[model samples]
Structure formats: structure tokens, C-alpha cells
Target: MDFSSKLYSIESELTQEDLDSLKFLCLDLLPNKKLLSIKSNLDLFKELEKHSLLEEDKYDLLAELLYIIGQHSLLRILGTNKWAMQETLKKNRTVSLYRQMLFQLYEDLTSEDLKSILFLLNIPKKYEENKKFLDILYYLEKNEQLSEDKLDVLEKAVSMVSQELLRKINDYKKTRVKENTSTQSLYDDKMKLSIEVVEQVSSQDRGMKSTVELVQHVSEAANGKDLMDKNTESCMSDLSLNEQSETEVYAMNRKHRGYCLIINNSEFMKSDPRLGTEKDADFLTNVFTWLGLDVQIRNELSTQQICDCLIDFKQRDQTERDCFVCCILTHGKSQAVYGTDNAFVHINKITSYFSTKNCPTLAGKPKLFFIQACQGKTHQGAHAIESDAVSSVEERKTKITIPDDADILVGMSTVDGYYSFRDIRKGSWYIQALCENLTKMVPKGEDILSILTKVNKDVSEMEYSKDRKTSMKQMPQPAYTLRLKLVFPIPLAPFKPLFQETN
Candidate 1:
């Protein structure tokens, strides 16, 4: 044989080590055939058939491997053989059925939800079949014909898909967890602690074990189990002097720390009209609250109102709190966000309030700022590191001096000068991605910087644009000055007693 033919022959041979490893794919799932007969990748499928007796994990592993292998082979054989082309055409129909099934399961999904879900599942949007899935979803939602039952099914499917993608992303994340592996703990790594309580309570109780079911249960319950305004008040009410109890110190202690301040500016002066910010505020409030922070949400604040709020938060006594987070959802050009009354508040002005010299209570704490407004009024021609609503393009680096002991992290939705995209119904892309990843990563013990890095990846990969002919892309930017790692601890249980008598 010539050199090329020899190379092919060598590639087709199964080495001893490979044979040893292949056994883990399961002998039962392997077809009854000679291993040497497979001269090309296309023919490998004939040896990868599964038997009914095989365990589920082995079967799944074999299936995933075979699917990948077959995909490669099919691309190599594209249009070469008449029979092969015909078979591939038939398989395309199967993929169509699967896509249709996904839509049927989540009928009420908005266009934005469909896009976010696909990205969350690591599904590729390049394929025509996937594009059709989105096209149909957009149409149905526009017509307001999607069903609630289907929406429920879609959420479950999205959760399953995320878990599957995460596993596939890590080679060591096998289908079966080893008995001695520490990963086999009683928790799903993706769950936030508050959501975990809701889930486990429902499961051990045998009534429900999911976010949706538990929320519905609370709403249906007779007592004041309502989680929104009422529970949030209970969380904040501890700060009041009149409501102070002797046992309060055990729960929250004397320090007014661990609060998430969300400033949502949806309405704007007639000069700069925008939509969909309110959606972001609502979702973020729910998420941070579920993450165990006492949330303070305000909407439609003007420039002065914005300043006052941050100053108040900065002045709070945070001795016992571990960290502080502030989120802003609004519109603006470079270097500032617009208050509801159309006034500009420089981003630094809001953040500077937390400096060690200014807010001594938060001197060493991690003060995080999440801004979801367009920084400038320019686009990088489909390739911009940008933020929410709309912004221009410009690269800026400014250093302001502060006291020696200060810790801060500022997360901008985009780079200095580009438009930040948001769906009229779904909210800004950055905030949604941020909330989901925080929920997914925090329970698994990921640090703040690592979690923000994932948020950057998640937002950057998603394709967003005002029009399809010229699609847009976004890349988030994080700037921080810290003396130590900022890892928000998981609150395993409720702080019921609130406080205790000092020593």
C-alpha cells in the first residue's frame, strides 16, 4: 500500500490500550462483530449498536460517542454516495421531529426565551433545523397561542439539557458517579441554596421538589407564606429599631450587611425612550433574594435619587455581613446611566460612595456593581464588547485614588462603547445570564471572579441583534481591585432568631 493508505490502515487499528478503555463503553452495548472489519469511520456505527441488557449509563455513553463518530463520518461522506445521501435525508426528518417535540413542550416561550434556552443548552443555531425551531417559536409567541402546560415542559427540558451539556463539557463527568466520589452529595450543584430548600422540602415531603411547584404551593397556602413583598419585608424588618428582638443578634447580628441593592430605571424622559427594563428588575430581585440576600429594589429613580440610594447603602453598618452587591438597570450613553427623569449620573459617582474612606463600614468587604446600560452610542459592526439597552463605542481607562483598604468589582454589560441588547419582553441579555450563572455556580462553591468569567462567556457566545441580516455580538467586561478572593458563602438555613445579646 502507498503511504496514504498505510496511514489510514494504522488509524483504523485498535491499540491494546484503546481496547482496554473501550470496555468501559460496555461490552454488552457493542455489536457482535469483528473489531478489525471497520476500515473507515463510517463503518464504526455497525459495531456500536446497543443491546437491551446494557445498563442505562453505558448505553448513554455509547450512544453519545457513536453519535459524534457518525457525525464526523457523515460529513466526510457528504454527497459522495447516492445511498448515503438518501439515508442522511431520512435522518434529517428525525431531527425535525425532535425539534418539533421541544417546541410542543415549551409552547409559551417568547422569542428571547427560545434564544436564551438554546444558548443555555449549548445548542448550535447554525443548523437549519434549529433555526426553524426558533422561527416557529417566535411566530407562535407573537400570536399569543403558546400554552402553559407546554411552557412547563419546556422549563424541565431546559434544565435537563443544561445538566447534559455541562456533563459533556467535562470529560471526567461521566454518566455514572463513582461510589467514593465526593460529587455524589445530596445536592445538585446547579441549585441555589434557597431553591435547594424549596426542592428538598418538597421531595422529602413527597409532594414536590422543584422551584415552580414550591412557588405555586406557597401562593396556594393559607398563611403569609407569600415570598415577594411580605417575606422581603420580614427580611428587612429586622433592621428597624422598633422590631428589634433580644434574639435578633443570632440571626443577622448588629451589622446591617449582606444586602443586594437593585436600582431599576425603566421609564425614561421623553428624550430617551426604551422598553423591557422592568422585566430585568423583577427577575433579578427574585434571583438575588433566592440567593439569600436581603434585597432592596427601587424603580424609576432620578440622578439624585440614585445617588442618595447608594450613599444610604454605603452608610449602612455592615460589620457582620460578608459582601455587598448593587445592580443598575437603565439606559444611557458612555460613562453614565439615565435616571427616569432623563438626568445623567456618572457610574463612578455611584461606585465611589463605597470607598474605604467614604464608607468605612464596607472598607474590606467586596462591593460589587452590576450595570446594565449601554455605555456609548456606537456599534462595533456586529463585534462589540458592549452593555444593555444601547451605547456608543469608546475605550476608556480612568483610575481614581481611594483609601489603601478598598475592595470592589464592577461588572459592565459590555465594553466601553457599544450597544447593550435586551428583548422587549425577556430583559437584557447580560442580567439574565448573570442571574442564571450565579444560581448555578454559587451552590457549587465558585468564586466571584470565576462566576463572572462564566457570565462573560455565556453572554459573548449568544447572538443578539436588531436585525438578522446584520446580527450583533456582545462581550462583558469586569474591572476589579481586591486584596483577597471574594466568595459568597452559602446560607444553609434561614436566620430565624435575627440577632442575639452582645457579649
Candidate 2:
């Protein structure tokens, strides 16, 4: 029999309920299939035959059969099952079979009824097709064309598509020639060109290394003669050593001392810019707050406002704080960030405020800056590295200096010339990972530097294949000249507050 004839024959032998059950079972098997497993197809066929044995048990049996099959495998054969189940769901709107299917395909249902139809169709699969389908379906459902029941069914049917299939679909769509109106196509092309241009100008791959070398060269040159002369002049100008003495005392009292200021610059000056900055800001704020630091979460700020915030933060309680942290989450160029007024401000200008000589409060403290901004635009295909136990010597060497001295740690979201992942909903990947690691590490008694090293590993190693294209990464570099170890204070939870005995 032909494929259609065979499908029809199976349907003829079973009641409508039994046919529905088999369809549901087939959908469920799609996503749960292992990479190399052949059992999915076999198990699904077996369950369909099993459900066919009972007449009255047919309606509920369809869902049970689909549920028996895995989500991964069911999604692979979604093309056939999706259409059939959708038709069934459309006809029998009130069936619980449809409801079960919708719940299963929540990720892929587009149009509420379609989502409901997909969900009701519930092909068991580990992966779903495009999220856009579901998003679109949801939009339609909100318009009242698709009932809640039908939306549920469609959701399940669409969800049964496999990750591999989803990837293939997305890749094909990206490569397709635009057939829309020339005007619309032209506008899209222009937008893409602009993004590419911005990316090229901000490429970090070569620029970041160059920046490091440049800074090293300048530091060496300055140290050779300029620093000594400046030190002598500064000593002559300022005789009071009280600040230095106070820093030493604070360092002795706290094993680790430092301050971290996390700023989220996710929003832009333009009211309706393509990217939103607030999400990034909120992610950072939550992280620093969890780390028990005095975190200042700001929205779109002017360049001057940023500088002033930094200046004020440093001035307050400078003597006791041993370290300083500043994180900027904004749309950026290679070495610049955008102010709320849409002006480009060089990063160096903002960081220069906390230099050893300029900011006395943070003079001897370890100042660390974490940035989540795209440095450049370049598209490099993902490459997998072997998971081998390499020696720790390969790790980047951290700069060491006196505690009553200067140190800087700067981390960028991407290597130059690459796009940093910004989720319109989830914020930047680096900030989320950084904050997540810090929150988890601090409680385990790990130091801040150690936490950052893990952050680097997490960002670099995450994979984003064409199928799951949302993945992105970042790079962090720590430069220091601290003579003492700096640690931030961890406040005791309110639940553990001390109770004084009445005298």
C-alpha cells in the first residue's frame, strides 16, 4: 500500500477515538528519541496497535499512545501527523484530546486555535519548530478566532517537531531569497548592511589583543621614567599619608575588601530602538544585589551621568572598601558605549576616573569593570574543542600588585567583531552567567576572581548550532597591582538575625 493508503487502512480498522490516540502517540514520540535510537518509530507503531484493541477506550487512548512515544522522535514525523491532528482538533473542539495536545506543543503553536490544534495533535517530540509560529498563533488566539481549547491542541502538534528539523527549517529560511516587495526587501537589506557595518567597526578579535599590547607598551614606557617623576612630584605636593595609613588598616581588618558597581545600560536614547537595555540592567542588578554589594541599577544615562555616578560611588566610604566593580550594559562600538542621548562615549573616558592618581578613594583598591556590549561584528562558525584536562599554566596570568595600590579587571561580552547575545527578554548572556556564577560562588566561599574565571569558561564553551542560534559569548581580562587580597562583605540574611538577651 502507498503511504496514504497504509495510513487510511490503519484508520479504517480503528474507530475515530483509536485513530486520534495513535496520532497523539506518534506526536509524543518525536522529541524524546535519542540521537541514534531507532526504537521511537517501533514503539509508536506498537502503541497505536495496542490502543486500536479497545473501542470505548479509543478517545483517551490516543493521548496515551502519543505519550508513550518520546517528544524527539514524534517531532521528526510532524509533517504527516501535524496536518491530520490539526483537522481532527478543528472538528472536535471540545475534546480533552485536543487540550492534551495543546499543552504538549506550547513551544511551536502559532495562532491560538492552531496552537490548540497542534497541542491537541500532540506528537511527542523533544524539540519544537520555530518559536515564531507559537508567538504568531498566540497573537491569533488573543484575537478570539481560536478558542482556548483549540489553541491548546495546536500547541501540542507543533511542539512535536524535532530540534534537527527546527534547525533545518531556520537555516533554509535564512538562505531563501526575499520575494517580498522590493521596497520592503530594500529596507531589510539596508538594515542588515548597517548592522554589518557596525559589527566591522567594532571587531574585537584583533583590536582587543592590540589594545592589551598598547596598554602594556604604554605602561612600560610610563613606568620606565614617567611614573617615578610623577610619584616624586605627587609626594612633594601632598605630604599627608593619612589616607595610605587608613587603607592599610582597613586591608588588615578585612581579608578581602572591594566594591563592585553594576550598571545596566540596556535601553538607548531613542525611545523605540531595536534593542532594549533595561533587561540587561535588571539582570546585572539582581546579580550584584545577590552578591551582597551596594548595587546601583540605572537606566539610560548620559555619559556625564555615568561619570558622576562613578565619582560619587568612589568618594563614599572609600577608605574601607578594598575593591571596586563597575559593569556597563549598553549598545556599544569597539571601544565606545552609547549615552541615553545617543552620543558615543569612549569606554576609556569612563574608566579613567578610577585611575590610581585620579580617584584617591579607589586609589589602592582593585577596580574591576564588567562590560556586556558588542565589541565588533564578525560571523565565525562554531567549532568544537576536545574536553581534555589541560594544565592550569594555559590560564591567563593575572596581574598582581599591592593592596594599597592599583589594579583593574575588564571583561567584554564578545571578542572584537562579534555580536553579543542580547535576548529582548533575558538580557545579555554574559551578565546572566556572570551574575549566576557570582551568586552561586560567593555562598560557597569562592573569591570574586575565581568566580569570573568560571564566567569566562561558561561563556566560551556554550554552543549555539544553527538549530539553537540564540547562543553567544564573552571574554574577560583581569589586570591588577594589588599587594593584598580584596574581598567583599556578605551580609547575613535577615532570617538569621542575632537576638540579644535581656539584661
TM-score of each: 0.47, 0.40
Candidate 2 vs. true structure, TM-score: 0.40
What is the per-residue lDDT of model 1 for residues 1-503, given as tens digits with 9 covering 90 to 100?
A: 44334324424533433333233222224532443344543234334432342232323333232222222221221212222333333213112222333323343344555566666544434542445444444433345543322343334445554553322222121211221232323123223445655555656865435667776554443232333334334323321212122211113332443889999876666444446676677777876776667899988898889998888888888877767889998876667777887667777777788888888877667788899988666443333233343332333434323334558888999877667887666677899888777766554444677789989988887886646776777888888886665645444432232222122
Report per-prediction Cα RMSD to one decimal: 26.3, 29.4
lDDT of 2 by residue, 19-132 (tens): 333343333333323311323433444454554632332333343343222221131122223223333333232223323333344423235534444455442343335433
Q: Give the TM-score of candidate 1.
A: 0.47
Query: Against the true structure, whose lDDT is highest?
Result: 1
- Any idea what lDDT model 2 has? 0.47
Worst 10 residues of 1 by lDDT: 241-250
lDDT of each: 0.55, 0.47
- Give candidate 1's whole-model lDDT: 0.55
